[model samples]
Target: MMLCNESRKEAAGLTPFLTPRKTIRLATWNIRTMYEAGRTAQVAKEMKHYNTCLLGLSETRWLQTGQLRLTTGETLFTKKSKIKLNIIQCYAPTNDTDDEKKDAFYQQLPAVLDKAGKKYMAILMGDFNAKIGADNTGYNEVMGTQGLGYINENGERFADLCSLNQLVIGGSIFPHKRIHKATWRSPDHVTENQIDHICISKKFRRAWKDVKVMRGTDISSDHHLLMTAVRLHLKKFKNTTNMRTRYNVSVLKTKEVRTAFHLSLSNRFQPLQDQIENNDTNIETQWKLEARKEKKVVLNTSRTRAAKAKAQEDYTATDKEVKKNIRKDKRDHINNLAKQAEEAAGQGNLR
Candidate 1:
């Protein structure tokens, strides 16, 4: 388990991208069957331990495809990806399985691939039960020569599907030790094969960082956990809450604005000033009333400025014009400062 964890941590540093919009650590494991007691918790525990966001489970032994929310706070999507990502998790028929069953699986496979069109990024991974072998031969585009075992009938079908869909077999591209590449082992521990696999769209081939099987995971299954790190580009959403709408107090430096503000303040207080003259009402009370009215006027002016700032902020946020405006404003401020400094120097005001 310690070895498994150290290797999983090493995968994090293997990412070569300077900036990834979003990173997803995904694992595909054929857990044989999820019918055993505490099986769900055990799987969830391992998932959380490795800090994996998404997991593709196979041979779940469930009757139909459906989703479930685990008590551990992870939502299992047994079928789909909500975002533009198309994730297809499947369990292919073994070599010994009936030919009719295999034919049905291959037939349905193309239909699913068609639905997850080439326009979007798709991840097709599961216990394929096919060994592509180290001999890539004419299949160099879809797979690599680093594969294990010899090519079989199932391998031919898988390679063809990948070629047609523009999907690259991720596991075959990276060279790893045989122990790290092998996905399944026999009871005697001598027999091992790289049957399970992960494949990604060829268009986003650079996004695939690494692919290897985690043999040290504590899951009680014949198949080891196959994982891959992929960098996915995501759309960023701006948060508008708590955006500062405070008026640029420096605007008061403009003579015209200062004059306009003073005029507005006088106009607002004129009525209060007149009321004070006409009141036989207590002088102190009149003064308090005038103060309250003055405070209201100031508050109203501040609110008007705030509304204008907020409107500008909203417009810039939606249009993404904030950076441009800020650059322009910076240039203007620098020019003004330089002009003021030149004038001061002309006057010999060194201080």
Candidate 2:
């Protein structure tokens, strides 16, 4: 959505709200498993319906964790920033899972949390499969008594992890109807629990406005979509060189426009030409002066035309090169993932 000068002018009629850099609508959804036919498309279509800017996914069941580029010119899991806002998506094993496997999952969380930019925002969210009960206890700063089920072993560990990492459990902090708070429902329609969660860095606690489980979307999954409204003002540095003022020279190509331009120039120069003829009466000198004036006009017009052409050419070339490099990066990223998957499979470790 970053536009050059040419495209900006062409799209000047667009509303200001259409600007790409603005408040983001972020959501986290454990889509169960996007292995079903047309599942990715279904998720993408729902994302569009919600006008989501960033969406964290879990249990994607992708062969290997890697970046992907959508056909709509957006990249997933490939953003880089100096002081970026990070979102760590996860899918924890259930309470019945082996202790060793669960320990391994928590063991890896520190690395992910630490990988985020220290000075920026970080959101830890996903289907943790840990039920945090309706008791805040000593963790008043990180959670609330609004949680659903009773605290289990996994919930204690999850709360401890949040306490250690200075993260606030977003879901527990907001008071909602029990139905709205519950993230997952059993197939029997009798058991409802808040296993899925969205957490934000405690440092940015004020930025997180609300968190709720949405049930309107029928994504064919027991888990509901958890959305959080986090106020973030994205700072954009304008490239001054790309902010040049340009005129619509193509308008001059029209017959009526050309006639108008010529008539205006004629009216201006005719008076000067008459004055020169009356005062100097030197034909050659008057001709030279008029030629100089006309030459100045042509040079000014030509320079503008040339500048416009050069800008467009540069934009086109840069765009082409960018697309080409992006395709290469996608290929390389996927290849690396494939290689990692093969290595993991060879070692009998495919998690």
Candidate 3:
């Protein structure tokens, strides 16, 4: 059977472990197969109706593993977060499958879990084709008494894997009706079982609020949707460091740019030389005051048609002159850098 997991978060209170609390609604469903046309749309529509944020789908009958972005703007891919939650969705080998294949599947699962590391709250879920049953005797910490049906060989293996990884089976932890506990049913419409499961790290078990099967949801699949409600906030981290500036220096190879830069530099810095020698501060202040006065006159101009027209004409001319000077200044600045780089390259010291 195929499995698909979806997650949606609602803001809440503070948790003992993380920052402010958030209620994350996570679900896993065996979609069986998405090989038919419009099947993907049906799943996406159902996901939106349920208000899911992150949804992991399995047995899609697509090629190799990769991301699939739907037209509805929702993305299907493996979830990875630096803050806390790390989810791994799987469609394990069936109970009747070869023992070697099952062994290999279980062995590879641990490696995947290990890669998530201890810092993250890892969630391992999907259809394991395992029946954990209602027994919670020796495995009290790993599960609860609310599990459905009787444990099978696959269930024993699944339980052991959860135990080894210190994962708590979400389905068994919460009390619910028998109808709400079963995730899969037989094609003959007689037998029902709870094979699909959702598990979370034991360390964050408190974060898990509830888990149950949603039997009303229909997608032409034998497996029902199993959902887990977890309470833990995802804290956002931001980079505060300033970025360095970069410049292009290859234009220095042009002789026209070098000549323009030389002329601009001489015209601009020659005034600075006179200002420094004469210690002229009042002249600069006078120039600023006169410019402000011109703007004030424009603002206070009479509202007559002729006066307005004249004022607009003057403003436009001044604006054009200012823009022209700005362009010249920018071009000169670029040319100046190019000239400097050319000189440096000639000296064999381009740095």
> Total clashing residue pairs per candidate?
0, 0, 2
Task: Tell how far residue 267 is off in model 2, in angstroms.
Answer: 69
| Per-residue lDDT of candidate 2, residues 243-272 (tens digit) | 678999899989999999998888667746
lDDT of each: 0.77, 0.73, 0.74
> What TM-score does candidate 1 reach?
0.60
Model 3 backbone overlap count: 2
TM-score (all chains, Cα) for each model: 0.60, 0.58, 0.59
Which parts of model 2 have CA positions greater than 4 angstroms off?
1-23, 72-75, 78-85, 233-351
Better of 1 and 3 by lDDT: 1
- Give per-residue CA lDDT, model 1, range 1-351, as digits (tens): 011222322422322322466666888999988899999888888887776766888998877554565666655555453323477888999988898998999999989888878786778999999989999888899999889989898988889889988999988999899999999999898999999999999888888889988877877899999999888654678887997778887999999999999988896777568657754344444555565555445545555778657655554443343344445556765676588668879999554
lDDT score of residue 84 within candidate 2: 35
Ten contiguous residues with the weakest lDDT in model 3: 8-17
RMSD of 3: 19.1
State how far residue 93 of model 3 sits from its true place (Å). 0.9
